[model samples]
Target: MKNTFEELKIAKSILKSLDDIGFKVPTPIQQKAIPKINSGGNLVGIAQTGTGKTAAYLLPLLTRLQKPEGNDPRVVILVPTRELAIQVGEDIAELTTYSELRHAAVFGGIGWTKHAELVEPGIDIIVATPGRLWDLYQEGVLRLKKVKHLVIDEADRMLDMGFMPQLKQLQEIIPARRQNLLFSATFSPAIEKLAEEFLDFYDKLEVAPSATTVSQVTQTAYKVPNYRTKLNLIRYLLEDEEKFTRVVIFVKTKEHAEGVFKVIQRKAEGEKRILHSNKAQNTRINAIQAFKSGDVRILITTDVSARGMDVSMVSHVINFDLPRDYDDYVHRIGRTARAGNKGDAITLIDPADEWHWKNILKLIRKDIELLPLPEEVEVLETEFGENQDQLREIDRQRKIDDPTFQGAFHQKKRKGSNKRSFDDKFSRSKERQKRKKRRKL
Candidate 1:
């Protein structure tokens, strides 16, 4: 087995760029994937996030497209989110520093005309989101005839975001003879179906099992009472600035993201930023940049917003709210413990989130340590509405497990209670009749 990039038969110019960027050895995924991709066959790579999956595909594709070709792109990389598109584009830019390979990263939120202008000059590689790519193609500004390499990065995420329709449309448009490369963090049955649709006859390469957490990360959970208490716990943990220096807090909803960011902004020691779908594209980009450069110590983001952020040296990842999608827990934690660096993942599990947390455990197939609430952190009483919401969620989970089981909130009233109500109504009607008769007499 080849261990180094050079032994893998990488081009000297690309190797020089890699060395300059401090890439010493190929990651396991890279070691296995680079060869298969270079073989010029369709390939499906299953690896967890933060495992250099991007480079595994990019290095070989870049090698194949060493120089600029036709006016249209020879390589089309499809990412699930704008963040991922930008990140992949940046990687390409860095890797091709010693070569002449023009590329463009096009996505939504910016004008399609701007992207058209970008590709009008001619591009060898085009990294784009599905929606934006389709728009450009439809506008006749971008052509697909010369696209020989079609890469679907984060296939699972694409499905989650409902990009299958666009992907299917793209499949019909792109030449059938093109090589397909699909990279996903998890290889579930859905991904298998996706592979069948996209890849003709591809080789499968898996570095790790699907939904597996990074081994270097220390996983721990805190059983909190409610959201307010979770905030208090976060404040308590952030008191240790040295330990929680660089943190990414993942929340389930934009509201939660905002709430957490506000709390951290006032209570936490260092700089903090918030990211969600509501934020402007430029704002989101700048926030990611700041977090990546270590200018910001903390980033509070929703799962959607943080999908493709590739930041190194993240000391900790805090799950402010457990993600509804079980696989997302794996992705959220993978944000830390990257590049062989040890990191910590802390999850705050409230009553409602515990069910999802348990499902996450089952998905990862591991036992996570549940830490007791810290002494300094005050566990506030659960609000009435919050308690009701927790109960409702629990009831929903129960119904999912047993379809016959009626939930507490929607349970039918007892026969005796119905009878009593009926009798009381009858008695009230009789009394009203008696009062009317007395008035008449």
Candidate 2:
């Protein structure tokens, strides 16, 4: 049975806020985690992104904050990145409009003075990135002793990016008797082990497993030979005229993201926006806002924007480069096809990424249909051996390196003396010539 938002037993002010926002029913994550949080028990919620995990924690925490019995900053949510910090802050702000809760978000890439100015006189809630929160705590601008609720969002991403140390430091300072909530899209073994330290007899809630993808997203892939060919394929897809109207492209690194953006802009008509780690905080925020407002039709981003972004109108998602972590694929594609809308997720696979390509299939546990590249897109690859004898020889070499070889083959030794040298001769000659010229001078 579907649970209604009013049945969650939240405070009247928060209920009115939910009505104002037209939140009729609780999402899966919200339905599970809200009850656990309201019970005053620590919880570990393993849910997918865009599953309303933010509201799962926010609604209950807001209700507790308005208890009027005790005061001091009652809630602290530690996120993985600055962008996520700002995103969560905005989501929480939207829900807290009708209440008297004072909240502030602290993150890097902004002035220290600004954060200090915001932290004064004790806020009811704080959303912060780990590093920036650590800095503020060290400077004595915030007090943790009175904190009643401690929430850690994106736990796996936090551990992946080496925020565990900072998170541990925070645990040492905050009050021991606080409600704890840990939310993550995917949880690794390391994170599962770490949960033992923070949560107390916690309720483990998982709406979906680690490898699940949204049902509304249609996943497809294209096999190309190299990066250049993949770029051409993206241009072709964008110019298809009927397939896409608004699209978000995900790449692996910041440099590749910008390069893809530049290539698309050079080939594509109309305006395009790029979102990566290099841009200023305001610029990144503006690009997201523009994309959400329908002013910008295309957004090129890295894994920085992969988690917890709730833009509902994206029509297409392009995986320009597959993420190393397969779980990220699910989050990247969830950007589109939201709110019962249909969307498509397309991936460009190059020859060099054969290993990474298999990982996606393994994660999805389903074979992805490979679409033939458009005729205008050229695939460049060197054919090793097409003839019978050459192909046999190549197979022989493959057996020697293959993991299943098992000492199966024996070959004759070479006749000549082997020159197994570590150093390059050309580099040695260049260095010697430069030294001799210096001596002559």
Candidate 3:
């Protein structure tokens, strides 16, 4: 196996950029993928988010496109979200520093005219979300005829976000003879179907199994009673500012993200920001920048910021709520322990979340260490409504597992109750009618 980027025979200019960025060695995915991509064939890569998958494809594609060619973009990279588009654009800007390659990162949440202006000047590469890309193509501002390289990053996420139609349309628009590259963190049947549709006799590579967590990250879970207790625990953990330097807290919903942010904002040791789908594009970008630059110590967000975030120094990842999708747990924790840095992933599992957490364990095929709550952290009583919600969720899960299981929340019915009630009402009606008739006679 090749150990260094030099052994991989990357261009000197790109190597210099990598060196400047403090990357001396090629990750496993990078090592395996660069060669296959350089061979000029369609390829599919299965690897986790933090395993240097972006650069694996970018390095070779940039190397091949040594200089700018035509007005239309030669390379089109489609990502699932605006955040990922921005991140990929930044990477392209950084990697192409020594060379002359014009690129644009276009996504929704702003005017399409602005993106049109960016691409109108002539671009060699374009990183975009599917919706924005389709809009640009329809407006006659972007042309796909010159595209030689087509990349779909985070394919699983695209499916999750329902971008399959856009992807199919993109395939129809782009040139048929281009090199296709699809990289995803997990390989599912749906992904296989997508590959069948997108790639033409492509080579498939898997650096690691699907849904595998990063080995560098230490996994631990705390069995908390409810939301209030989780907040208290978070407060207690944040007290150690030195150990918990940079953290990303993942919540399941925007409401919960706001709640976590409010609590952390008041008592946590350092600055914090919240991110979700509802936040404005600029606000989300600024929050991500602050978190990346170490200006903010904590970022409380939904799964919106989970995939394609390339922060290397995150000290810990806190799962404030279990993700509804078991596969997302891997992506959430992957935000930490990036670029070969060791980090920790801590999950606060309430009673209702236990079943989901167990399912996550089964998916990842590993056991996370369970820890008792800290003595300083107070475990508040679970609220009545919250308790009932938990119970209801538990019942729902039980019913799913055992079709015949009658849960506590399930309503009970006595044997022959309906029949007996109907019979009693009929007898009373007949007796009243007979009494009326006798009186009339």
**Could you tell me the lDDT of residue 204 within candidate 1?**
89
How do the residues 9-30 of candidate 2 rate in per-residue lDDT, one tens digit apiece?
7878888888888887888888
Tens-digit per-residue lDDT, 83-151, candidate 1: 999999999999999999899999999899999999999999999999999999999999999989999
Best by TM-score: 3
- Per residue, candidate 3 scores C-alpha lDDT tens digits across 96-134 of 889898999999999999999999989999999999999
Ranking by TM-score: 3, 1, 2
RMSD (Cα, Å) of model 2: 8.1
What do the candidate models score in CA lDDT, each in turn?
0.92, 0.80, 0.92
* Per-residue error (Å), model 2, residue 384: 13
- Model 1 regions lying over 4 Å from their true place: 413-441
lDDT of 3 at 331: 89
* Model 1 C-alpha lDDT versus the unseen true structure: 0.92
Rank all candidate structures by their lDDT, best first, as comma-separated numbers. Answer: 3, 1, 2
Backbone collision count in every prediction?
A: 0, 0, 0
